[model samples]
Structure formats: structure tokens, C-alpha cells
Target: MSRNTESPVDVDEALTHIDSRGAKIRKEQLERTLSQLQADSELTADQRLAVERLSERLVDRLLAVPRASLQDAAQNADEETIETAMSLFE
Candidate 1:
């Protein structure tokens, strides 16, 4: 009979390591993007701060609500609201 090469614990550990690495990479990317946005000379400091705060608020809302609730809210949003939100991201 064929035999397993690795134990289930080993597989779980490898997956945990992969997840940690992915999270670290995402955190680094977010830091770089935030730095770039804050360093933009075209925007006043206050404007840059406002943009950052708006992003943080959106993140807070996401964390506060269930995924389905957020999805439903997005789906139900009117065209003007959707366009405004999309434009802000762009």
C-alpha cells in the first residue's frame, strides 16, 4: 500500500507558516501604499490625513459588520452612492 510522506501536524504547521507569511506581506504592502499616499505633494497635509481617516473608517465598518451584511449594503447602494464610493477608491 502507498504510504503518507508527512503527518497531518506537519501539514498544518506548513499551512500556518504560509498564512503568517501572507499576512506579513500584505501588511508591508499596505504600509507602502499608505506612505505613498501621504507623501503625495499635490495634496495638502490635511487632505491626505482626511483620505487616510476615511480609509480607516471604512476598514472599521468592515470589521464591525458581517461579510454578508456588507455585501448586501453594497448591493443595495444607489447608483450615485456607488459611483461616489468607486470614485473615492480610484
Candidate 2:
């Protein structure tokens, strides 16, 4: 039997592949992708840092949404839940 010797995938390489697709992924999808990359055992220290920074940027953008908009979207939701969501930015 022939043996396969392919190397494990790198996080940066995976990111490059995703970026090359040129399709806009939703924030939640991107967050899930990044979380998967972060969990990869082959990730180097730099790759882990990059993944963390990207996650932070995503969270920052999410938290930047106007409070009024979030409130409107979550109509019927309790005020405490809305405030808890907004507090993630702080």
C-alpha cells in the first residue's frame, strides 16, 4: 500500500484559501470559521495570534452596530438581554 505524507494545514494557509474565494461571508459564518481555525492543532503561535486579532476585529464591528438598531431587531426581547449584548463591546 502506498503511504500518504501530506502535511497538516496551516491556519494562515486556510485563511488565504477563504479570502481567495472572493465571496462575502456573514459575520457569524466568519466567526465560526475563525473559531475552527483557532482550534486547529497545527496552528503556530503567530497564526493563533492572527486568529485572535481577527476575532477581536469581528467582535468590534458587531458591537459597533447602533444600539437603536439592535433594539429594533430584538423587539420584544427584554432590556437586560439588550444591555448584556451591548456590554460585550466594553
Candidate 3:
């Protein structure tokens, strides 16, 4: 018989795993892009600080919402209301 290697995933655990994987990719990209920017002298201290702060805020916001609820709201929303709600993210 073939052995199952995977643990049964709970919804929250699954989401957490997905987020962890995405964060790894994002971290690598950020490191590479930031190194390039530093090499090119493209960013000021204030700009770097602003980017760090905004990235923190975005991670906080993402963690604040349940994925199912966000999906439901987005799917059910009418266009204008969705646009307004999306504006709040910006």
C-alpha cells in the first residue's frame, strides 16, 4: 500500500501555509529588487522607510480579514461598491 505523507489540512492551516509560501517568494523578490535599487542609488532614506511601513500595513490588513469573507464580499459586490471598497485598500 502507498503511504500518505500529507497531514490533513485545516482551513486556517492551509491559508497560513499558502501565506508562508507567498511571503518567501515576496521576500526574495524584495531583497533582489532592493539590492538593485541600492546599487543604482534609486531610493532615498525616506522612500525606503515609507516602503517598509506600507509593506507592514499591507501584511496587517491581509491578516485582519478571513479569506472566505473577502472572497464572498468581492464576488457579491456590485461594480461601484466594489470600486469604493477597493479604494479603501489604497
Candidate 4:
């Protein structure tokens, strides 16, 4: 029998949520996390991309939950999400 290690076919994407009470705090935390991650030479491009995607996707949800920094939130995040949001938005 063959084994399928991936998520079920119905699961189109996986999401991670971050929480923060203040917009300024959330922005600072997200920026710090992104800058740190972007600077890391040890992480692969795909790994960074996935994290960025998850962070961008969860901005709203992140602001909803009880106060939590994306620094902590991103750490708790699953380390991967859906697509790319790294390209400069023109």
C-alpha cells in the first residue's frame, strides 16, 4: 500500500494566525520578524516565502485575538503557508 504524507486533497491551504491589540505594536513586530527572517542566510527561500505568506494572510486574524506579538505569534506559526507575497507591490 502507498502512503500519503501530505494533507488531504480538500485542504487547499494551511493558515497560521497572529494576534495583537495595537496596530503600531503589530506593525513593529511583523516588520521585525520579517526583517529578521529575510536576513537569515540559513533559511531556504521557500521557507522564508511560506512564513511571509502566512504572516500577510493572518494580519486581520492576528489583530483579533488577545494581545500577542507576531514575534511570538510567528514563532508559534507552523513555519509555512500558501504562496508568495515577497515581490515588490507595484
Best by TM-score: 3
Q: Candidate 1 on 14-58: residue-level lDDT in tens?
A: 334434544565456557876786687566778757765665665
Residues 1-84, candidate 3: write the lDDT tens digits: 223365422444434554665466557766776788789988998987776666666765764564454445445543333333
Relative to the true structure, candidate 4 has a C-alpha RMSD (angstroms) of: 16.3
Q: Could you estimate the TM-score for every candidate?
A: 0.36, 0.33, 0.48, 0.30
How do the candidates rank by lDDT, highest first?
A: 3, 2, 1, 4
* Model 4 ranges with Cα > 4 A deviation: 1-27, 38-40, 63-90
Q: How far out, in Å, is residue 37 in model 3? A: 0.5
Of 1 and 3, the candidate ahead on lDDT is 3
Better of 3 and 4 by TM-score: 3
lDDT of every predicted structure (CA atoms): 0.47, 0.49, 0.55, 0.42
Off by over 4 Å in 2: 1-35, 38-41, 67-90
Clashes of 1: 0
Report model 1's TM-score to 2 decimal places.
0.36
**lDDT of candidate 1 vs native?**
0.47
* Descending-TM-score candidate ranking: 3, 1, 2, 4
Backbone clash pairs for candidate 3 read none
Model 2: lDDT equals 0.49
Error of 2 at 6 (Å): 63
Q: For candidate 3, give the lDDT of residue 29.
A: 61
